[model samples]
Target: MSDSPSSWPDLATLRDRIDDIDRQLQVLINQRAECAQQVAQSKMAAEGDDTHFYRPEREAQVLRQIMERNQGPLSSEEIARLFREIMSSCLALERPIKVAYLGPEGTFTQQAALKHFGHGAISVPMTAIDEVFREVEAGAVDYGVVPVENSTEGVISHTLDSFMDSSLQICGEVVLRIHQHLMVGENSRPDKISTIYSHASSLAQCRKWLDAHYPHAERVAMPSNAEAARKVKGEWHSAAIAGDMAAELYGLTRLAEKIEDTPDNSTRFLIIGRQEVPPSGDDKTSLMVSMRNQPGALFEVLDPFHRHGVDMTRIESRPSHTGVWNYVFFIDFKGHTASSNVQQVLQDIGEKAADLKILGAYPRGVL
Candidate 1:
């Protein structure tokens, strides 16, 4: 390992070596894919037509192991990402999966879906989170991805509420680091930009940055960042605040990148589907509980978790649609429902709550 250029192989020699490595990689990848096909065949032989090709827990475990064992020139996350696509393509060769996400295209939800399921899986865009759930429930798509919360913007109430009426299970989670940019189309006037368009959340996220840069501009909230990017395509005096995906998709130039007030802004998305995901060692369980409108009702519901040593990660309250209960609490805790401690905690909470709904236990986000 010499730092000197003289000790390095010549350009042609290095390229030839790279070509040899690429050939080896291709052969190994095909071998892995063939193994996956054989695994599918084995399952189909045993389970007949009901064989499920995608296993969220299994995939999560594989990715985690890949990251843990990696000692490479590539970062762990980068290495895991490469393996994710490899596994995704292998899974697709067995049976291609379909994912529905809230989108008009180029939105973060779509990005999350692609990040979690990989580009190998087909992604369908829907108008709303409810529609995403509906499509997964109706068997139109194999899975759905919906935004659960943002680090800067807090929880998405619509997504939490959707779980109350839907029977879909949380199969996995994806965490995407968000980077908002001020973009303008080729036809737009960047110098005299008079109006800015974005989703309400994006506008809020970049409020401080916009105030510092374009305080005089009128802000218009669209249904989505994608729609906002679409709107500025033909406008000479307008810019859109959106992510890189939207800008690239709409062929817009980013005038100001990473414009969000918070430097580490990110969003977490949930994968929903008809089938339940088994324990992946590292897991989280979400629960919707309605406690009796009485003194210490919340404490009573939470005390069991403390006693059982289950780590509660997040808690949010939403007004109950039913007149019988005043409100419902959405709780997320670390650990799978199948674990003995989690089972005990849930049993204890079940006794104290007016209504209890275990949304699903799913693998924690790996990237």
Candidate 2:
């Protein structure tokens, strides 16, 4: 350590350099903010009083470009997050947007909301998924974020059914890596875990881990993981299973971490809003198709996508509410509705299916 003292900076010298760099960064950041404000003014001048300041498609493109050009000590998500906050601040300067997510705070949906909209957004916690949908439908919030599917647990049926009742369009999507942890409050008896609490899905997710570790412990299901965390604080002989966000919020200690059965467990969330997003270069379109009850109905509905060379990403079927509405399928595929081939595919599928509704076309998750 002493040998390279001549070429290396002393502690004081390094501190001084850091201070100078920070000052320069602060100045540049303010300059960027000023430019963003000017952009707002220009948009107002051109689009009048009813200008839409937040464009999910445009934001996705910017984040994608930033990620693509990054050559850093930080990961792409880190860089994109830094930019997200900057954009959040700039968007606030123009006009702040409200985001509604399924939460009581400290839920994964809340984390996803902050991830997509940044900390500057006014994110409200809704009691249920339908509440989030209603908030967006009533224009109470600018957008809503809800879980569509999880890698390990499969599709979120509630979210899919919400689309059937709501007119909101899908504007963007975010995929969050889920890490469920076993946590205990400060006064909890770690050795005497008589009961464990978590959401039903979360409990199912960590079933094997629980079976091996706390097989004799009483497994209780709650409304949400966050609620479990909240309850664990008052129960001395209990523990809660949740994520880092909930643990931090409830001041709980982690007894076990990332206990999900799958190593790469993740959940896909959709951003729903009133506005229709124009095509970003890379986009995915979601649609709902109700097929007639017949032998080849499923194949007839999907055959059009194959014939048009339209790439299908996912397809999930839910039971129809009515007799004629035999099979309801939620389909996600590449390309926008505006594209000719996609239009042709839709036309073909419309003929085959009893009913077809284009849910929305949106930019693919970039970060």
Candidate 3:
């Protein structure tokens, strides 16, 4: 009852109160940053300069705690993101982690990298997925973010293949809601648009929408959505299909939004790093299993997971380079590799499997 309209503060009074709160928030945030700096100094003194200041497990636990304790007008994710940015800034005060993503900039990978690492991270855009892997593998960057799968379009085979060749371990994961938009340059006329440029995957995702609305338009596939956005900058009768970030980056205007066939079209990305992430209590493990070409070989690989009471989250098969008809199983399951149940099943599978590589057990995406 005390929060009734009659008891509400006036506009001037409310603005003044908000201003005071903002001042307090500014001071507290900087104080936290200073403490982060002190912590960094303490870590360096104790463990030397080679110490890792950015702990994915610790960050995940902190975000989960923030979400669990949150009971407010704002959504849990909204508050978690606020805390994420704060942590990001504080982490930068300690040391900025350089992350490489599959990008030319303004792409979905860039968005995911920023979402998981926050703006404080230094993001390096690589031309290809393999390049992203190479950067992380070579220690050129602290981490790499690459798309693993999309809900609508299925798996990104290139990313998986890159992982097969690389030695980098999966450290974390992030799921991004993919929002495809039809955008155009400032001089482009809506009525004059006859051609659309986008990546092959984007075009496929929006196939139904294209059939319904712009069936006659020429659909050209490019290297990336950002590249498509780049190409359309000088053309009058051209438009690009990309995300909001690309539109803002190239000064393009959105003519249509969310044109993907599935409403909840989302992509899951993995954070690849050199060091293995310690268990965050709540975690998921990804592994690649290979078996000789034989009947029920798939069953042999998956049955242990079933019998062990382990939850297998995803499974995909990719061609094995060793032979023409051979295949490898890429699997994701819930549980840390260090846990008893997971370790038991992994050991059992290793015996029957031609080769089993523990990719890494990492905290599931918190935001």
Candidate 4:
């Protein structure tokens, strides 16, 4: 009954103060959401116009500003994620979004989808990249998540090829740092493992580690890393290379962590939707072009970017499928197509190349 200042504060009083703060927060959040509802209504009145639904550029600028001014125990990434959820909730107030990603559940691509869409989104798992695209194109899903490139292994050709025919636009992107774990069932012994299974890319990424440890074990490839984890239930002698989330989902024990060949191995995923996204201040545009199978065709394709002082971030060539000698080039430029310089470069490239298609422009993924 001393009521000393150092005595632990009364539990009921603290709870009441917390409740008051919560009530204020609720009121402010509701006010902000009411503004979102009004924006949605104005958008609907525009008829066939989508300007009010979302603004990627504005969102990116806002996140950058938050990160710049952030001073806290939480990192910029954590702060950005919290804001992303708030923005996602606001967008949901306008309309619920459906997203599709390659999966049977617990795949890395699924994680990327959730990161981009937030937990409020309706996420559907498709079996393949093309399936995700098909769903997006058919309006079965509002967006699709597909892996475009990996740091160690280069591009996913199937994903690039799928873009050749799809009309979907790239609205956003997410980069996930891949950490491979050597997982086994609870009863399994790491030293006694005889075989390992994983997706081809995962296997390749961890090849050196596997060779050093399980030199004699048979390495098998599966459709996905998640499948590999699922296949190792009762076999004490078998292990799988998978992500930490997959291991937890499959109830597998981690024998080793960060088993990838490189410390910085990451995969970039594209967010495909029907609507074009406004420039996110920091944005990247992707395009594919087929040039005449002749000397300097590559130079002709890229010269405009240099002449216009545009930065070319990535350029890869794949077989055109027209013949043995033909090739198609996929390029990633550091600007949006809506910009004047980028527009001029695209116009010049189109006139020079045999074929040119702007895949989509999207916000650059921040690591």
User: Among these predicted structures, which one has the highest lDDT?
Assistant: 1
Expressed as tens digits, the lDDT of each residue in 79-141 for candidate 4 is 989877887888888787788998878877889988887877889899888999999999887
lDDT of 2 by residue, 102-129 (tens): 8889977899999999998999999989
* Model 2 TM-score, all chains together: 0.78
Over 4 Å off, model 4: 1-17, 48-52, 151-155, 179-203, 208-259, 321-325
* C-alpha positional error of residue 27 in candidate 4 after TM-score superposition, expressed in Å: 1.5
**TM-score-better candidate, 1 vs 3:** 1
lDDT of each: 0.91, 0.90, 0.90, 0.86
Clash pairs, candidate 4, are none
TM-score of 3: 0.78
lDDT by residue for model 3 (1-367), tens: 9988778887899999999999999999999999889888888999896788888999999999989998988999999988889999999877798999988799778999999999999999998888888899888999999999876544479888877777889999999877999999989988888999999989999999989989899999999999999999888999999998899999998899998888878889999999889999899999999888899899898899989899999899999867744879999999999898898899988998888888889999998
Between 1 and 2, whose TM-score is larger?
Answer: 1
Give the RMSD in angstroms, all C-alphas superposed, for model 2: 5.3
Poorest 10 consecutive residues by lDDT, candidate 3:
150-159
Worst 10 residues of 2 by lDDT: 149-158
Which 10 consecutive positions of candidate 1 have the poorest summed lDDT? 149-158
Q: Which stretches of candidate 1 lie over 4 Å from their true place?
A: 1-5, 151-155, 179-203, 206-264
Task: Please provide TM-scores, in order, for all candidate models, with all chains considered together.
Answer: 0.80, 0.78, 0.78, 0.76
Angstrom error at residue 124, model 2: 0.6
Please state the error at residue 48 of candidate 1 in Å: 2.4
Candidate 3's error at 179, in angstroms? Answer: 6.4
